[model samples]
Target chain A: MIISEMAFFLLVTGALILTVLAPVVLIGLFIKDYFSKSIW
Target chain B: MTEFALDTQTALFIIVGFALAWIAFGVWLGRKNKSHEDFALAGRNVGYAFAAATAMATWVTSNTTLVAPQLTYQLGVWGMVGYSFAALGLLLFAPMAKRIKQILPQGYTSGDFIRLRYGRFAWAVFLVISVVYAFGWLVSLGMAGGILLEALSGLDYYIGMTIILAMCVGYTLFGGLRAVIATDFIQALIIILGVAVVAYWLIDNVGLTSIHTELSHAHPQLLDLLFPAAVMFLFNNIFFGLGEIFHSNVWWSRALSFRKNVAYKAYLTGGLLWLPIPIVTGFIALAAPQLGIFPASADMIGPAVASSVLGKTGAILVFIVVFSALASSLDSLLAASSDLVTQDIYHKLIKKNASDQQLMRFNRYCILSLGVMTWLLCLPRVATLGALLNFAGAFVASTIWPIVIGLYWRRLQGIFAGIAMAAGTIVGLVAYFWIGFYVAALVSCAVSGLICAIGVVFNKSQFSWHQLQENEQ
Candidate 1:
């Protein structure tokens, strides 16, 4: 299977952007958890 | 058997080189292992980098390569995009990293929480679903090992399977989780770097002009953002992945192996890094029309493209990446499965007073026994890899709500939790042969949630918030 340059760029760029942001999102969750007092 | 353009001997040499190098590194890591804690959870010392890499690597498997493409081909663009929702599992689990390390500060297995928080019946219910889900997962890896070997090396499936399972089980049993995690980090690196390199190479070779012309003229479905399977893929996959991680003790037990700070860092990092996998592997299949190689099967596209693009050497690299993926994933499954059996089944049932020393001794046996059972089960064709795995997704989706609610909902009674999981699995299995996964998860979670909600509203049993406490966590 082969993808077009535009398609590949779109997919790879999207994936890369998400990958870069994954850590930031997790960090945000970590901070939120630190302050929360729910039962879970 | 499929014939790649690459020479078999060269491929073998390259793969052997990588495996031998990683095995040596992993063996060396295990030499300092002294305690059961060392054996099971890497003495709670793994750093964020190691944890993050292993988690990401393990979750992205042949499925991403095999199933993702099939979805793209059938459902169009939305299929590929829908699958991306699985990353939500890792993202949701981000805060769970801290909670697990904090609440189960001394916890060893997912089963530990059940016993302490939900009592014997709840523990028993959780154990059944977990074992079934885990065993199914182990079998899929074993199946992948054999299928890849047959595809790449023309080795007989059984011979390929036995060798793969034995090697994975041997190392994990010998060095335990410590060995598994170290090897996992390196394997994760190979997968990430290899996929990145190939994705770039393929794009350069194919060129954008030719691709757009070819795909639009032939498979215009590739451009469709929302296909008919939209609702099913979008919601069910996210729910399925989340349920698997949240309910099974496998991940937390693995998490506990890392040092507290490291575990948190690793999960956060792993969650993000894991985001690229589905696109990398799945999109390769999407490129099929331009390569003049229509994918006979979604799973075969990765190997085929590697062979076609980079010739024999690239094919060999693909093999190594897949092999590394299978090994990394299988070893963890073996380690975690055996840990559950030892900690839940044996300790709970056979030996109530088993000492740490005795437990460790029994755990070694559990590792081997579980490995053997899974090896036997996975040896069969079990239909296609995609179908077999989807079958599992349906089964576990039912248990998701019960687990999530049990963890967080204070009023969820023990009876409600236990009944919910049992009834959910039973109903979900019924849905499997008849309906789509989205319908199954939705129905099952609803069934379980309703039971728990009813218990909360009308039951005379004392509802203690302590049943699912936030103590220290």
Candidate 2:
């Protein structure tokens, strides 16, 4: 039971991390596109 | 009425402020439009960043933010994971987007591909499916905007719905696809940051150990790895998402609008970015019971948990995130669906000789009309958002096989493609009533695939790839 609970926590935490990181990566790419004048 | 997390006045102020800002930005972006192509397809030169952002943001819809948690609350852990599988729609579409760019370089809508590839009969059938799915989604998003506001703040359903619909239509009317894509870039950022903030707060405040322990004691099925119903729903949701993206003009127009080399990678990046969102959003619902926040309706669980946990600030965040999600999808659907009407119905069928300027005017009118129609349908708030979306599964999933086969294979005939969509939809609807919503898309996709296989095996005439090109016109 404890093992299952730990797994669930790990899964949520991992997903949360990815979710937070996604915007940072996208915003960086957006800046690159903006500087290149590629964002038509 | 139920008590709200924030006061109605603050909600109204935020809603109005966002509406004005988005509309003004849209008008500013519209200044560069010179032709129909510019209006409908953003001059067909959208960059990688905007394309990927629009794709991801549009897919991170009310369904992802609201219905995902609702399903998780109901179907447990597998439900949230199943919801995330919707990213497969965008991922699989990467190859199709490339093919769309290659085959029909001048394509304007998904309807154009169907008409050219399969002919009028299949195109007509495809249009019905497309319109139904678009309106279903549009109405759901409109209603979700209202429902979100009402859940977090003491706003009336009708007022919230009207503000959202009008705001999206106003901007889409002004800037067309360019405005839609640009706003989508910002909205995408807001939605992601807001969802992440709420999830992070929930984790920090409630602690995952406590959440898991509470769920284990109270809602054990949510933690069950092999939960049967959620397992069943997993693939069905995937097929539904695939069908929605594959056949709808929303994704199709984005594919067509992007610079040639950017379509594949843009969709792939979008899918990857979108993959974890449902899990993050849905995880918040699992903490509902632990937080002692029981929403009157399951669909409100996401906002309720966020607001109840973090108080007024959380309510404001939920409001903005959901509003952005709704507007992102709404504007895209309006622009894409209107493009379908203008290109496929008005230009192709009604006035084949209509000038570019005339077509652009017609497209704007179509957007306004579509907004009105969706507003009427959303007025009553007839069904839960989840149920309304799932019901559309039967209609859209039927188109998956025909589109996939038509794109890559050469043997499938127009008549068979039409028959496959029609027959698959009928059977899928029957199964929806007879079996369950979870099986509708699965059954529809299976039936359509079977019919498409039969069409391929029995086909005699070979379809030339060049028929899909605009040169035929």
Candidate 2, superposed: residue stretches over 4 Å from native = A1-3, B470-473
What TM-score do all the candidates reach, one by one?
0.88, 0.98
Give candidate 2's error at residue B298 in angstroms. Answer: 0.9
Give residue B49's lDDT in candidate 1 (0 to 100). 54
Worst ten-residue run, lDDT, model 2 chain B? Answer: B464-473
Model 1 lDDT per residue over A1-40, tens place: 3344566567766775554454454445444544652101
For candidate 2, write residues B1-473 as lDDT tens digits.
27778899999999899999999999999998989999999999999999999999999999999999999999888889999999999999999999999888888888888998999999899999888898999999999988988888878889989989999999999999999999999999999999999999999999988988888888888888788778889999999999999999999999999987999999999999999999999989999888887778899999999888899999999999998999999999999999999999999889999999999999999999999999999999889999899989999999999999999989999999999999989898998899988989999989998999999999999999987764444
Give the per-residue lDDT of model 1 (tens digit) for B1-473. Answer: 25745454654565456556655766777676677777788878765555676777767666665566666556555666667677777777767767777667777788877767667887888888887888878887888777766666666778777767777877787778888877776677676667666666776787546666677788875765544455466676776777777776667786777666666666666766776777766666667767777655556656666667877666667777778888888888888888888877887788978888787778889888887898789767766676676667755666666656655655666777788878877786677668765456555666777787786776665545443345313
Model 1: DockQ against the native? 0.14
Best by TM-score: 2
DockQ of all models, two decimals each: 0.14, 0.65
lDDT of 2: 0.92
lDDT of 1 at B151: 66
